[model samples]
Target: MVRKKFSKKEIFTGIACTLFALLILSLYVWHQTESVSLGYDSAELEYRVTQLEKEVEKLETIKSSLLTLDRVENIARDKLKLSEPKEEQIVYEHIEKER
Candidate 1:
């Protein structure tokens, strides 16, 4: 029976190769995890944007209703106690244009 003994250099080389392979595998796993995390972050941001858009639409509707002519007239009449001026209290203005 003949047995071949491994040299110290060969043993060290094999260990280094195994370590390098493990490092590559770990880097791959890390990259995949990072990609998944970014996807979740993007989804969360999209959801937040959708919610903000809805809120903006609601706020715009409220503003539109508040700015209606009838709403403004009612607020002025009820809050300021104002009324239309009579014929004697009304005034007119005239301007002459230069030719």
Candidate 2:
């Protein structure tokens, strides 16, 4: 039967190697966590961008409709009762004094 005892130098080298391995492992885990967090933030920003694009498209459609002659005529006729003047129609204006 034979048994080998480790020398002081060998034990110290083993401890140093173990510590280095632990440090590397901790750094790798931290990097992985940060990567996941960044991915989630990126996805959130993408979703917000998509929502804003949809809103912009809707606003563009509304703007186009508002700029049409037909839409303007409809609003003027319905809201303001505007009409074309006939030859027989007489117009009068009365001015009020501002106090």
Over the stretch 14-61, how does candidate 1's per-residue lDDT look in tens digits? 999999999999999999999999999999999999999999999999
Off by over 4 Å in 2: 1-17, 84-99
- After the best TM-score superposition of candidate 2, give how far the Cα of residue 47 lies from its true spot, in angstroms: 2.6
lDDT of 2 by residue, 11-96 (tens): 99999999999999999999999999999999999999999999999999999988899888888899999987897685444433
Best by the lDDT measure: 1
Cα lDDT of all candidates, in order?
Answer: 0.92, 0.90
Q: What TM-score goes with each of the models? A: 0.74, 0.57
**Model 2 CA lDDT for position 71:** 84
TM-score of 2: 0.57
The CA root-mean-square deviation of candidate 2, after full C-alpha superposition on the true structure, stands at 6.2
